[model samples]
Target: MSDDATPDATSERAAALGLTSPAAEEGAAGPVRFAVVGSGWRAEFFLRMAVLMPERFAVVGVVSRTAERGAEVTARWGTPTFRTVGELLAATDPELVVVSVPWDVTPVVTRELVEAGTPVLAETPPAPDAAGLRTLWEQVGASGLVQVAEHSPVMPAHAARHRLLQDGAIGQVTSVQISSTHMYHAVAVIRRLLGAGFEPVRITAQRFAAPLMNPRTRAGWTGDRDPVEASTILALLDLGEGRSAVYDFTDNQWHNPLRADRLLVRGSHGELLDDRVTRWLDGETTIDSPLVRSQSGIGQDLDGYDLQHLSFEGQVVYRNPFVGARLSDDDIAVATLLDRTGAWVRGQGEPPYPLAEGSQDHLISLAVEEAAGTGQPITTEREAWAG
Candidate 1:
């Protein structure tokens, strides 16, 4: 944590993360006023989004723990940047706050924001571990003001697979299978598709202390706690209803990273195998699912992350016949969902990704991590999610 972390936590300026439509009378050019809570790498992405969509959103204020880093970003973006949350809030009054700090800092930041009456779209894992995530969830339940927004779940690929299953492209899903070891994303993708109302019957994880080839290990990237590199985590999730998904994430091959991500969905009627995401009507190509894979550079909000490179903009798996175009169905779904979510925030209509519905995923992922840590099966309450 940075030196001013303690003061930032206790300060009243560390506003929460969320979106609230300004009075209809506020009108255009007024923009959706926002203040980013961090000036780190992730915060830079939100800054870029504000820059790209100036007509819709404006980043009027920012707070960073590091004085130098804070000044640098403020100078570059020409926004009011401060060393503490109190300073940032004292300088500007914005309608929305976007939290873009690290994973570990999320809970404290969230609590402060919620208490201060700010709505947040905090970054993911929700927290570093299960207990931390539960605490954040409980905090949000009590606050009644903060909004937990997760992006990867909003990344297009997962959204498409979700639609295929819901629309009955696959028969009444008797089973489900997700294959990936990326931990955060794998668990999120699985729960989103399984409708967040399913229970886990079993979970098993295997780990190996392998090396990862990255700047974290080579250059001491963030700090000591950031694993220079350690690989070896393959987990299999067994869900009743004859559904299952295998998660394979080990750093063994990461020393020499390969095609990093992949997902396959099988159902009674069809299967979306690998990057193609093709399904067969009676196992024939003529019946292939007609959804276009939305790989990198396609429909990127016209000019947001791509030109700025503040955030990653590419498919989870690249199987495009064209180089650099890793389009897939899962990609399309997530992209569409994000558009819908943004529109909802702008008061155009309701969001496709329900906030309450999405919370269930966080709960399930927490359970998976617990099962992995304990080497045991954990069960979730299906009926409890009836909200």
Candidate 2:
């Protein structure tokens, strides 16, 4: 269960619903009951998380269009599958639904579920473009039933960095330099860290081309012997109030070790370069600290391998809630989003990342691509969904 989840409430709800939950059986809160739509590669993240953390999450069913796909998923994940959302809902009630599908299909699936009154955690780029976003907003934006799985903000290192900023460690962040994830995902982290909060802004962007070796993936390394031409994009965002961000990324940077991840956050009193932090301590003294990481379950450790937490200056900034799950950094972040979403649905916590924030993230991302293509600065304006 999430740190914020109430054990008694979950168990009581499960018992009242006549559902046999693992948590309830263990005399604790039951896991969050949710379903997944679209049985595909990305859907594996939800499946794996449920498998790894059964006490925290439960999969009611998976929505697949074909019996063949449904059988495949069932064989691998031990979860029943349905051909449609209505079929799944008719048999069982899930508090949340996760939509993982192609870019264009997201808004349609999410709209159907939201109109059906199911809370949804839609995949990134909630819609493919601004027009679709506007249409989605007009249809169900005010329903308060959608959250985007933009997980970068909750990634361990990034979460620690945001905590520092939130705690005034940097004395009010002024600028953010990110060459981390690409496009919408990167924009989400940038806006969250800078505390931009859907503010209107302008973006000027450019792209450069180069050749490099694109190495590994979740599957494994691509042993291909040739270098591929890669495109690099740089975007400057004016988020108003002297709060700005520079987004730089190259194609396949997420898995390309040739291009290391880079982040620089600047504030009134100091800056953080990667893990190193340099800031003014008392107007007259300058101090430096490093974001230290802890890991276990390696070598002689019998605890099983996983990330523990991130600390700075003798303080734990971000701790992994799924330590025994053996999840990767990205998986941990996504799981955190799922856990938080469950808590939000139960009215136990704040909305994880609302649809408005996701829309704004993608809106800026679309502008970045447009600016890169047009060689001009693009200004962001208030949308009908801005709140």
Q: Whose TM-score is greatest here? A: 2
- Quantify all predictions' global Cα lDDT against the true fold: 0.53, 0.85
* Candidate 1 residue lDDT tens string, 201-249: 4666655565444434222443333334465556677777677777666
| Residue 251 displacement in candidate 1 (angstroms) | 3.3
Instruction: Report how far off residue 143 is in candidate 1 (Å).
Output: 4.1
Model 1 misplaced stretches (Cα beyond 4 Å): 1-30, 174-181, 198-201, 209-230, 252-256, 277-286, 289-291, 294-347, 351-363, 380-387
**How do the residues 148-217 of candidate 2 rate in per-residue lDDT, one tens digit apiece?**
9999888999999999989988798999999978888999889888888767889999999988887776
Q: TM-score for every candidate vs. truth?
A: 0.68, 0.91
Residue runs of model 2 more than 4 Å from their true location after superposition: 1-29, 217-219
Q: Which stretch of 10 consecutive residues in model 2 shows the poorest summed lDDT?
A: 1-10
Alpha-carbon RMSD, each predicted model: 9.3, 6.3
> What is the Å distance of residue 299 in model 2 from its true position?
4.0
